[model samples]
Target chain A: MALASETPRPRTWWRRNQQRLTPWLFLAPGMAMFVFYVIYPIIASFRLSLYDYDGLSAPEWLGLANYAELWTDPAFTTSLYNNVLWLVLYLLAVPAGLFIAIFLNQAVMGIRIYKSLFFFPFVISQVVVGLMFAWFYAPNFGLLYNVIEYFTGKGVAILADPDLATYGIIAAGLWPQIAYVMILYLTGLNNVAPDQVEAARLDGAKGWKMLWYVILPQLRPATFIAVVVTVIGALRSFDLVSIMTNGGPFGSTRVLSYYMYEQALSEYGYRMGYGAAIAVVLFAIMMVFISGFIWKMVRDERGVH
Target chain B: MLHLRTGAYAALAVLLGTTAMAQQRTLNYYADFDPAPLAAFEAAIADFEAANPDIDVVLQNFDHEGYKTAIRNFLTTDAPDLANWYAGNRMAPFVAAGQFMDVSDVWADNGLDQSLGSALASMTIDGKQWGVPYTYYQWGIYYNKDVYAQVGVEVPATWDAFVANCEKFSAAGIDCLTTGTSALWPGAGIFDYLNLRTNGYEHHMKLTGGEIPWTDDSVRATFAEWAKVQPHITENHAAIDWQDAATLLVQGKAANYVMGNFAVAVFKEGGMTDETLGFMPFPTINPDVARAEEAPTDTIHIPAGAKNVEDAKKFLAFIAQADTQTKLNMALGQLPINAGSTVGDDPFIKAGFELLSTTPGGIAQFFDRDAPAEMAKIGMEGFQQFMVQPDQLDAILERLEAARSRIYK
Candidate 1:
């Protein structure tokens, strides 16, 4: 009895709380990593936005100067405008993917082969896609150039024209993004309730009505995922712009992410503070959509429970 | 027991290895050299090592593009004894940040002020020499002789004659001037020549030094000269790379290319023999202005944080030697910066040597090297924009002026 009373208090406490503490202990390592890499950097970037640093010398405090400069900077404005264009145009991938998914979701012979072929683009690296598309749009001897020349008597170099370069890069990005969305919807379509689909078909619901009323409702999870991925992809578009245009023909094709890189780290750029300010703005823009997504997810979980 | 004995043996071996390394000084060199130049540099290092048997030189080669970013990181965190960089304002940032060691004493000891005189000004910042220049290649018009002959045109001696030749070339459906601005620096080469010719070396220096406003009238005058050939430049050049444009010149679709001597190799590789390829000085734009040339010097500097400063300085002195530079540039197929060094028998190298040696006006580094980096990027983009849309000249100038105000301050 004396020994039982003298048992270490810490061990007893651990025993008492083991059920709750075990999960948290398991989560500790991952949570620590998340705090160090993700949370810390976000806060650091916010603080860095107010300083004037060139990545070599000491950072000078500048208050709101970096943010204020962004408001007046023409390059920043162009990047913002291009980002908006990307966001609007990038959403088109979701519907296009849905259409392709429906078309490929069939029981015909060799449908799997066709589906895989359609999914091939997503598997390829972004750099390769950018290179392929660059060649396709190249002037003089490119395939698209030759075809356009045959039709219009003069080939258009889409990447060279400031008015069209952003669109050209966006089209390249959509090629792979659409493939990714289609794959997601394809998997979603497999789990759909076939009985509901049959009921709608028997009720004389045709193509559009049946899709809108029964199929799409069942594909809500897929649609939500597609929208979220597409939005994130649009916001973080650096690779295609870097590969295809490099914000050239007078920086016309720059998106926010690429512009931030240009301001901070490119061969000619070392304005870390200005880059941080641009990053802060981009983060804020993303937070709006991300928070909306989180709110919706929480509400959906509550409703389900 | 056997495993424990083996582990003990491995530990002893590591300890011995470290002790041996500590006994001999190691000079770490970080360089970004293409295959040809890398071989030349390695050969030079062998000679240096043979002379000083105790000092070991360790070389870490990086890809050219990646090195630009890597140098910034390593210079701060893990500095090497030696680093390869460029001359002029390109090195200004490192100098200003005190990341590069001041090597004036080495220059004084070696009498480099006389032998490396041509690049002396470029290597100097605030009256102190920070690096040693080994090689610089000339920039001029490399033309397709066959294209010139087919168009029934002779190489021009004056700007007007060049403009006239452009009309004839255009009538034959040939691009008069071809450059790829996708990377954006090629267009600056053209601007450099025009600015150098129109305003002479002093004014050009003033303009790039940010003393003169970008929207100044003299700057507009240079643009006005550029306007003459804007339409005759290759269409859709913004989508192509410099090598692709070189292909156009090689195929005789383009008559002339205002490029550095490096393009001569590309021209030769594309099946142009010595007879088919011809080099000429950029024509006399304003005969009154003394002739200036563009020869961007490649240099080596000692990092401030370098551990083996003495051996690194010895390496610099060896690189500055006339014979060493002569042999190095021979392999590099470039012009040696040492005045006493002899150039090879290559016709392009000879022509460049002659063109640069006799220039009364001072030599200007290429535009990107001469100007601050931010200004250079904005300026090159503006040049590309102007090439595509001459109508946007006002907008482009205003934009550059705005950038200048923000960047130079």
Candidate 2:
């Protein structure tokens, strides 16, 4: 009994409560902010989606009229197509970033400066990025036009042409997005287990095979983060649309977010209900991707044990 | 000396008491114009303060885009005493809800029609005057004289002449036209012009109001007509800023531009010599369409809850007078709404007023202002897209029809 009393327990009573209480405490601040700003508004918007509120009238309960209208809306359809295009093309940022990060991972004098300069676009405001791209693509006066004219004998104003305008805007959007993913990969590469990499190298693995078989498997967290950011960035592509074309060259650039603005807040009309419905539809589409991500995360969490 | 001091104290007490009363019953007045109108309004409000000495007028200013949305939202929030709003179908939905105060009584009491002309019609909804008309502007053609002169193209007055002029400019490698179409917003006038010419004013109104279907022959013909002049416009105009288009005209990069008269400032800012600048109505498309050629009046309004409604009405009355309109118009280089208000010494203003007075027929409001916003956006984008690629008409119209069906329904 004396020896038992003298011995130290691995966990105290406080430690027994820690696993249960610590997570809640750590989560409290983020949870509070998330519930207040993000979750509550989403529920509020879903509630708002059911009403025929002009934002001026007392919100009238209109059942699913807003949702019904969405099915028939060509504007909604156009925006949906553009959004799909954005999502698909935005994935290029990940691979492009990875490639750039690999190229940048060289031992040279002033390499740090080169990396920061490469990542500079990401730090700049999207508005500034958009403006720079607009100037860069301006028909007769832009740098791209000068290059194209030198090569092709015809300078195409990319933003002014309907067939190419969305792509042009998307390209502008990708400039910074690629940089962001590159920085993520750079960080991931910095944390890469050199011992494991050296062991894999001793087995005569290198280049694409080396990256694929060894390096990338260790880059799981960075890739996951990069994917999350890219998906979110693609969906929230309003600034570039607003600045570059404003969903113009005939509404061809209208993404879901911009179309929602066009529907609700624009001089076009105060169709808050219609806009809310569009938002809900977009939210639903995002939720699909989100569920997949969450499922993967849950599996990873279980694997951690 | 004591008697004089007593008298001074009495007057001071009265002034303080009046100011205190005004503080309690202050009314907020909102507007969207620049400082000139606001300055004039504040000056008038001072006069109002000296007169009523109780009801204070709080002046609020918003940018034009913000004003449009704010007015719509104000029906839910703290509405201003008075505000500036557009006329036509733009005002219809709001007026339908009886959200705006009916100023017909004040309007009639002022004998507004005698002085204001049909300009008041812009503000009328369902035969009721909902707000007091304050300031309005004309929309028409603003052009570069040096470019026209260099290209040897006269400002076309007739339909045949306009097309020929466009052909000449195109042959000369000069872009004959320019306007903004980037947002499918403010720069939708070209589509409105084609519709106005093809079916005349009534059909233009009907089509824009969602009363006529998009598949209507009148609308089709309008699209057909615009497709003819597609090549004459500046290359990459869809990407050009309207202000920059005016800049282009001023810089001799383009020959002509169709926009509101407010662009006169932009031309001057571009360093175009005043003699090099010229203004005219849009050339007739059908010749028999009875085109006013000139768009009409800049607008101002009193919102739903004005504290100094009586004073505001008085100020509106004062502004409506021929002399005051002339003074304000001359100061701003805009054409005065009142008939007898003579154009000032500014050559462009003189030419603009000359076009307005000499032009025979009804003045139609520009598309974005005249057509409800949704139709305006769709119509403009479709027209612009179609102009760039003519083969898209059927698809454009189908999409428009889908949009129209939703909006109209």
Candidate 3:
């Protein structure tokens, strides 16, 4: 009431400029939050990477020492290798998802139910998927163990073997990832211009030829989204690795995300600065992909305009 | 309108007064992740509150693994009045940073020196007691008595007897030790026992303190001794968890397992009784070396950031009482550190009490608790690797030595 009584000058100014300023005013709150939570933290983490902190004492400035240490650290090398493995393996989901989407695209009885059933794993959390897969691969009594033993007379404990553990987790991760991609492709298929398919059929283009020459190019937008999400998900593969192996048998399953968490937290006792360094590396890797995607999107937008 | 505003102010003051009168004080207590212990802890708090009605205890329990990470966050900001944490080197960093309130006065006032003698040294830092030691349990070789009887071998006290027993168990088609190294720490237990038995407790302390290198002769001997038992351990042991390994022991497929006294509950849950389960200290490698056992102690502390110092002190004193310790440990299936507390009739508890109380070289907290956490993580990983491939001892040691030197500095 006091401000209203005293602010005629401010009110007159607002009335004069509100038309031009309304859009920015509307965006201010959200943009400020983004800057604080996202942009500020990224800058802070980069700064912290140059110091040595244990989240307790005052941080000591050791510019580039953490980065220097990373080169010689075998654990870092292993984590980097595993991250690349995850990236390469995770891309397999896009095509697998498209295949499943095509298979389920028919107008059959209870087809909707079948679609939802195929999308079940994606609906559940990654933690649950990891647990289910852990059970499925458990040494003596797991379903996978039983099947393998039936054929070879020896059960394979997939998660227990360090050499095999990361691949096992990646496979578990792909179960839901594939479902996600399938849903995206299903949505894309719905809007895929049915006339084109019919026209291609009239030209006697069918099966793989039809999919390759007609359907796939039309589904590029969905493919783009699937590839983007898969890349992000693969790099952020901490939950399954943490839940299943905890980067064990001997830290063999650590990706950059899990390794950063282990350093920053866990009973390993906060090496926050070193953890920040790892995060910076992960962020730089992610930025390369993000920038490429954004560049393509911008080019597409320009072409559309 | 003026009269109405006056009345609203009067009412607010009255409500605040009544609330303050009704609940005079609150003590925020954060408990560690252990459901059974939390139950007993609640009971103890109930008694304390009844005796001192002015103070109200607000308790929150955390999941064990989550709590391990959350403590670092909460201890520095929004600290609870009292927190449950491990003793020994695990508590050292928090103490060194002055996050924990030194309650030496409480110890003096309550005469806890007499009751908590067993865990005093571990809880003390820089001549001050930072926390109250409540409960601790012993770690030893947990064996299936049925297998031992069938094999006709008695409890082994010397290294030679231990190896011969393992050989006998192996000959009888039972794996000698059923341990899960997938989590990494179980393998460290084997390392702890071997180091304590071979080099004595002093050397073990020196090594954990980073005064001794990993490639030291005494450390090599400890690993060398551990290598002998590697042959008799379960195949593909890293693939299973401790509970799974315990299942093998309970099912009589494996002869023995080395674990903390906590496994007694798991074995009991597996349908084994006190009669079939036997507990023995890790055998002595050097008869002349004083016997130091692994007994991890759990302590309660008032974080320095706490709001209720007086109440937290009172709570700590109440927790240190023999009755409280007895009930807490009894519920948790562990031993009370209170010297005056009676050990429950559970034979395993009795044996643990007997072993820990009588150790001439005193009880060292387990490997993960005794060493700095980062070094401990790397060291335990090395131990696990060595168990899987005994020939990689030198490489593992070199890696551990590198980590240890870097961490300690």
Query: Model 3 chain A, poorest ten-residue lDDT window?
Result: A4-13
Better of 2 and 3 by lDDT: 3
Predictions' DockQ, in order? 0.88, 0.56, 0.62
Model 2 reproduces a share of the real contacts of 0.79
lDDT of 1 by residue, B14-47 (tens): 4664677777677878899898898888888888
Order of models, best lDDT first: 1, 3, 2
TM-score of chain A of each: 0.95, 0.88, 0.94
Per-residue error for A26 in candidate 2, Å, reads 9.4
All candidates: CA RMSD (Å): 4.0, 6.6, 5.9
Q: What is the C-alpha lDDT profile of model 2 across B195-310, one tens digit per residue?
A: 76667877877777788888877788877777777778877878867776676687677787877767887888888767888777667777677775536445555656555666
Between candidates 2 and 3, the DockQ winner? 3
Give candidate 2's error at residue A224 in angstroms. 1.2
Which ranges of candidate 3 are over 4 A from the true structure?
Answer: A1-19, B1-25
Candidate scoring better on TM-score of 2 and 3: 3
Fnat per model, in the order given? 0.88, 0.79, 0.73
